[model samples]
Target: MTTPAIPSTLDVALWLFDQSRRDDVYLPAQKLQRLLWLQQGGYAAMNHGRMLMPAVFVADETGPIEPTVFHLFEDSRPPIPARPIDQVAENHLVRMWRRYSHHSPDYLTKKITQQRCYRDAWRKGAGTVIPFEAIVRDFTDLPTGDQMVRAGDGRALKKWTPSAKPAMRRIR
Candidate 1:
């Protein structure tokens, strides 16, 4: 694939961790992986297949994981040289956090790994790379994506919380 929108994965990870802290929650490594995967999928699906970060996802039996991030964050967050993210990309990530970060780690794992992309890659064998195209397809049709399935009043599907302000970011 071509170069990703964000120069580094740590940039996004830092932003996510900050957001979780803002909400008074601890971000687990597994949950962070799912957010990264979802952000990649959502960005690609909505923005003509451009990736959100320079990361590769592999099926790990448990779920899809950005290996570089998975290993680096395996125990805990290592010393990171966080970089500024593009304003547009930051906006997209903010939306992603609001949309899905409220869900539990197990919930995210089930929802993401159950998709055809993860299933096919995993069936190929553990650590198989999931193509960006397959991920784009999965995200495009996801019921919980921006194109959410409508229900009566749709209030039950809504996940946004009114915040005083957006999470702070070092903009590019």
Candidate 2:
């Protein structure tokens, strides 16, 4: 089987930021990290073990985070400069944002941390890397894994085209 191309951290972050902008909200970097983690794990569960993106995650002071994403929007601000994302990735990201964007960052963090994958990987320590296998294992055990497979099969998020418009809402 062929491996899928992994998106750079910049493209993924901008794609996520673009979705939040469309929904008229700003997703803090902390929350965005959680979303990416979910997106990666969920996709892996659905695609016969293929990771949507190869982002490396580490347990941070707040939660699991991709270091590049953390630094990209570390200011807790928005309007991150847009970056290009391919159609396949954009479709997955759009659905991911639609599914999880409504939750507050703190809530997302709490929810993910409570998951078995995050909890098990976190046993290593704050700076330790969370293995991709742990994440995939976690998703495969949940109902959301089924949803991700359906979303990929249906291409349900293709209708939402991504744009570079700046974020309209500020984190309150």
Winner by lDDT: 1
Clashes found in each candidate (C-alpha, N, C closer than 3 A): 0, 0
Question: Total clashes, candidate 1?
Answer: 0
Which candidate leads the pack in TM-score?
1
List per-prediction Cα lDDT, in the order shown: 0.81, 0.72
Query: What lDDT score goes with residue 135 in model 1?
Result: 84
Q: After superposition, how far is residue 51 of candidate 1 from its true place, in Å?
A: 1.0
Tell how far residue 46 is off in model 1, in angstroms.
1.5
Clashing residue pairs in candidate 1 (N, C-alpha, C atoms within 3 angstroms): none
Residue 114 of model 1 has an lDDT of 76
Tens digits of per-residue lDDT for model 2 on 1-172? Answer: 2354455666677777777777788777788888888788766766666777768899876889998778867875446566666676667777777778888988888778877767766787787888877777677756442233454345423224578896699789
